[model samples]
Each structure stands twice: as structure tokens, then as C-alpha cells.
Target: MNRQAQAAVMFLLGAALLHAGATDLYLRYVKAGLQPLLLASGAVLIAAALATAWYERKRTRAAKAASASASASGTGAGHTHPEPRISWLLLLPLLSLILIAPPALGSYSALRAGTALQKPYALGTLPAGDPVPLSVVDYASRAAYGQGRSLHGRSVRVTGFLALDRTGTPYLVRMALNCCAADAQPVKIALAGKLPPVLQPDAWLEVTGTYSPKATHDPVNGGPIPYLSVTSAKPVPTPHDPYDETWNN
Candidate 1:
């Protein structure tokens, strides 16, 4: 690409990153911890773009001065090749990010993806609360191994998008991202008891429930799917950050 186009692309990309950070939109694509990095990187890109523009201006002026001092056409600045049209397509994502950022991974991607279960860990004790809030990753992990002893009898609340497999079995699902959406995987919990009549896919839900010892098999993998014996379930607006960030760590 020409220097002008190169600088423009850099500026647009930087602006897009800044826009994501400024609006907390980065949470949709990456882990929460990357917020500062996103902001800083955006600033760096913009600075580089400005510097490139400045240098290009200076070079152009010097070339013009040299040409003015020359009497022959051969002494003038050489012609610059036009940048490839395909290169401009790079701005599509940047413009989308700045103008209409993508929504977080939802039921469509979650249900399509196979379960991503991390090795079980000792969660020890439940936190203090009437309905203790828990991440979907934690609940799913515990339920995956050691019979979920930590979650037994505890009134735990978890949030996730609602989804149903081909069998119409409802699950409370959340995507777990390693770094970004390209590596996103779904952590699903089979929800049981006291379900609403109308459970729409991609609808966000906060469910208060106790862990059930019995589990179901995944339709795709046939692996043990964790169960949550729910006490209450209510639709809630989607959160700023939708990925279950705890699992990757």
C-alpha cells in the first residue's frame, strides 16, 4: 500500500481499538484483563500512523524542492505505483469495530461447539451469600469431576445464554475464550427443574440452583454433561462481558 493508505489503515485500526476500549466493547471479544493493553496498543498504532504521515509529508516536500531545482523531467521524483484495491478490504473490520461492533458469542456458536471442559480442580468451599454467584466455568468444571462435592447443597447462582441441542434438552451455556473468539469454546450445564415455558435461545439467564449429582451425556461427544437442579430462573439482559473467563486460567 502507498504510505498515505498505510497511514490511513493504521489510523482506522487504532481508532477501532480505542472505540472498543472506550465503550467496554473489547470485553465481548477478549478477556477482561486485556482492556489496558487494548487501549495502549490503540494509542501506539495511532502514534505510528501520525509519525508515518509526518514523514511522508516531509519526504514529499523535499522531493518537490529537488524537482524544482532540476531543469530535466528525468530529475523529478519517480512515479509511485497505485496500491492494490484488495488492501482496502482491511478497513472493513476496523470500520465495523468502530461503527457496529460484533456482539459476543451467543447460543448459535455455543450450541454448535463441542464442550470445552478443563481439568477438575479443588474449589474448596462456597462463598458466603444467600444465592452465591458463581461462574459457569466453575460450576461446569466441578460437576465434571469428583462428583461436584463443593457445589452440593449450596444455593449457587450462575449466568449464561440459554441453548438447546437437537434433542431439545435445554442448557445454560457460556463461551470460554483462551484469548479471543477464534479459540472460544462452550461450557454447558444441563438445566433441570422449574424452567420457564418459553426458553429462547441466546437469551441471557441468571439461574439460582443446587448442583445435582446425576449428569447427562452430551449429544455430540457423549461425555458427561453437568446438571443444575434449578430453584429459580429469570431472563436478564446480556452482560458487557459474556465469556466465562475463569476456565482458561
Candidate 2:
């Protein structure tokens, strides 16, 4: 290929890698840890493409000089050489993308949503016996803040997968993360009333309940035990975009 063609091929390949890397970073890290690396890689690739173009231009100039000298000497300049082709270089980025497509975050990570994390205090008193629409993320965040302490033992409703524990009860429920599973926290809630008729892991449900603070008693460490209490449990459907229960973006 001529200098222009070679430069074009390299530029395209670099651009492809940059795009693939960026997509993977976003999907896997959710704009958390992978963003800096993605940006740096993109900058490097652009610089490399520019450098390649400059080098190709110099090579073309030298080739032209040789051709002109041969013609001036009345030599057989009719002997034509096929241009070099570097189109294969474009495959580099394509191969990288195929090899490293980040896997979707799945059910495995949802189990780790709330353990060891301090539940949130309620911002204010919850309405008693009144149905309130709530997001799983909001619920989880509030629980983390203080388990709705401000709600003053009022009932609240939350929807998510019925992550049943080994005891066959809806004790430790969870939601999956699309990217990082390691950070998943199990949402622990005390089932106040009777257990659901069909308790199954990964089954979706909405639970309505009153907030009750359980006394803390920690055996593993000297620190005080975390309060664990809630009431009025009811089942509901899994929300749309189940993977991202938080809906915070």
C-alpha cells in the first residue's frame, strides 16, 4: 500500500481498539476504576497514529526520489512494483475486542448487597399501614444509612429478588450487579410475619413492612452488634432492569 493507505489502515485499527476499550471500561467498571486507563490508552493510540502518518510521508518521499532518478537516467523505469498492503493491521483491535469482551454482571453479585454495612437511619417517620412505592436502591441506601431510623417504626415497602438463605426462609435477599460482584452485599431483613408460600432463590418479590430495630450483639468483634428488625412482609414482582436495582446511575 502507498503511504496514505498504510497510514489510514493504522489509524483505523488504533481507533477501533480505543472504542472497544472504552465500551468495556464503562460496562465493567460503571465509570469507576477503569475510566482513567481508557482515557490514557486512547491518547496513546492517537499519538501513535499521528507518528505513523509522519513516518509514512517520509518513506513516500524517498520512494519518489528513487523513481525520479531512474527516469532521468533513461533507465527502464517501466518496471513497476506493487504497493505494500498493511490492511492486516486493522485486525489487531478486532482481535483484542473478541478476546476481552467484559462479561455482564449477574445474580452472583446481588447476594452481597448489605452485610457488614451499616443500615441507614430513616429520614422521617413512615406512614403506618399506608402503601408506599420505593426503589430497591433507595431502600438499600436508606437501610445502610440507619435502617430508616427516622421512620419511627412505620411500615415501608421494597421490591427485589427473594434471595432465600439455607433455612428456606426469605432472610438474606439480594440483587445482582452487572460488573463487580465482589462488592455485592446481602440485604438482610427480618421477616416479621409468616414466610411466603413459595420461597425460592432469585424469585422476585416486593415486601411491605414496619421498621423495628433489633438490639446489636457482636461476638466476632468487641464492637456493638448491628440492629436487625422490620415487619409486615409482603411479596411483589421484580422491577424492570432487575440487574440495576439501585437505579442511581
Clashes of each: 0, 33
In candidate 2, what are the lDDT values of residues 23-88, reduced to their tens digit? 543444343444566667666767777888898788879978988998899876555677645655
Total residue pair clashes for candidate 2 = 33
Query: For model 2, what is the error of residue 141's alpha carbon versus the real structure, in angstroms, after optimal superposition?
Result: 6.1
User: Scored by Cα lDDT, where does model 1 land?
Assistant: 0.84
* TM per candidate: 0.91, 0.47
Model 1 RMSD, rounded to 1 decimal: 2.1
**Residue 237 in candidate 1, Cα distance off native in Å:** 0.8
Residues 125-155, candidate 1: write the lDDT tens digits: 7777768888888888787775787776678
Error of 2 at 40 (Å): 12
- TM accuracy, model 2: 0.47
> What lDDT does the true structure give each of the candidates?
0.84, 0.51
Q: Which stretches of candidate 1 lie over 4 Å from their true place?
A: 72-80
